[model samples]
Target: MSRKKTTRHKAIIDQLSVNPSMRVSELSDALGVTTETIRRDLEELAAQQLINRTYGGALLRQPAEPVLSERHKANVEERAMIGKAAAPLLKGARILMMGSGATTVQVAKRIAFEMNNITVVTHSFGVATALSLNPTIEVVLAPGVYHAGEGAVHGAQTLRFLSDYSVDWAILGASGISPAGPTDALMDAAEVYACMLRQSSRHMIVADHSKFDRMATARFSQWQDIDVLVTDIAPQGPLGQALASGGVDIQLAG
Candidate 1:
């Protein structure tokens, strides 16, 4: 297929995935293509078993599982900056709750050395293990079904355990973000993060700048849900304005 045809097909797939039953005219308007062209792309996607043809447009097929580890390595510096920005918030925290992510792991290391009287609650093996030997800090692991690839505990048991106590602060990471909200690449992770958010008083999101423009499979929280957004650089333009308007505090790390 030609480049134009491929682009049209991808657009149709994205739209159908988001809105399973769109009219051809709606798809055309959204993609800036003629209705006939939308129909052609729908037919092509249906032929590839990518979608199910409806009366007008198409229904989305199930998407493939995303590779989480490869994505973690994509922006190392930004994550480090986010870690540095988030560290200061942990200074006075007595009970800290952290979620699983490379950035959160960095934050864990930063707090391990400086913070005392700290009781760390986490679903991440990385965080738990990192602070395991810190005599000044106490580490509490939330028990649940562990996924090796993600190296985090998740499921009903974890959520149940987390609900039993509230924390002073919760630090989290997102797979992506836009003006609407922050999202996760995995549904299971999103569920666990939601539980963490509810069990903490101060909700802090530690996401790198790259997460700002992307989209993901499962949305966990809106920008408003976050009390503070600790990122490497300040987000500019409409996204930044939207976050600010939503009362999300922003912090930039060098």
Candidate 2:
């Protein structure tokens, strides 16, 4: 378009890089433009997912893992099938540890409706809320700092509380799973899942095929730490070899 408009777009991105957020008035004043122009700019940037529009301003978007709420809506059928396939493994579980994840939330739904008379210790509020629907299942929430973005808890207190107890199984989900192992997008989340696996007799990872071979921020569990992988598809290539050689059972939900 015009040179002025080109310059304005660059200015908007640059200003956001400096302060990460600004009001329409502030940007308009700085750019020597009308408030309406700034609003239009913001609308354009927001449409590109470059920033999040606020009531009166905007927040610069930082690249990171997808929001938990949005992730719940993705891979719905695959996660549901993985959840259903994981049920037989929990057949006789007494006390268990579950980590926070969209796929784990699906597993929690099954336990809440089908299973009975089991106690679960977890850091995810979503899992707790789901399991709470069943009066017979006791839900123990781990003490920690609540993370609104993840709808879970993670901190020193959570690790300390979990370390004190042993459980029949530790069930978790992963953002990525490669030859190295299962991983999470957040360091705190990775640490929490690792700790849960260590304290349980059997460790199970519930993830869809989308996670296969993808590497995330942190690898939390080695194959030795994982007993079963409940997924929607069979592991292929190096992922398949690693799991087999490492003695980790892969159960395909399909």
Candidate 3:
């Protein structure tokens, strides 16, 4: 490939990383390239399995996760607030289900410190270890294929294991949520979360304000699917009202 072609391809990948989906014409204009050039670049990227070609443009083939160390540092205050907000609701639940995310890890820590005699089921190694230190909590790790960078296990085997047992409540973390629904960057992650939601009687979403209105590559569930949403602050505007009208309880932490 020529220098220009390589540059165009890199630009397309960057755009798709941020937006997930885009039209070829939009990408062409954004990159200051001709439509035919954009099309050729898209074809090459698709061939390499870096992207999936749609009718007009392409979607990123795999959603990327930040390194676990880096992810642990982002949004510290917001995650703590979310964890604090979620802790009270965890009381008296013998079997607690938690999802994998930085915020959810904080929730695990909070649960370990505040609650006792709880059996925690999770795909997050971080959550399992965090709670293990408490000794009061019994951690049940679901078996599956581990994704190293994300530090979470996912796949059909994991889902099947989750289906065998039901939990009193499930606390979930999401990449983004809007009026439309909760979404994840990766489809596999979404699938695992969907299984957790299905197996649990009560569902709660733990997210920060930054997640509001952001879109992701795949959707796991709508706002209605959750019984409660715990965040640092209440969402403002139409999306917040939509969630309220839909009978989803909102919990905001100080």
- Candidate that scores best on lDDT: 2
Off by over 4 Å in 3: 1-65
Tens-digit lDDT string for candidate 3 (1-254): 88877887888988977766677888989999899989988889988878767667666664465766687898999899888889998777899888898989999988988998889999999889889978988898988899887788999999999999889998888876666677788788889899999989899999897677555667888777789999987876555765887789999887
Candidate 3, position 238, lDDT: 50
Estimate, for each residue in 117-156, the C-alpha lDDT of model 1 and write its tens digit. 7899999988887777578889999999998777898999
TM-score of each: 0.76, 0.75, 0.75
User: Candidates' lDDT values, in order?
Assistant: 0.78, 0.86, 0.83
**Which pairs in model 2 have colliding backbones?**
none
State the lDDT at 108 in candidate 2: 95
Maximum-TM-score candidate: 1
Task: Name the regions of candidate 1 deviating beyond 4 angstroms.
Answer: 1-72
**What's the ranking of the predictions by TM-score, best on top?**
1, 3, 2
RMSD (Å) per prediction = 6.1, 12.1, 5.5
Of the pair 1 and 3, which is ahead by lDDT?
A: 3
lDDT computed for candidate 3? 0.83
Clashes of each: 0, 0, 0
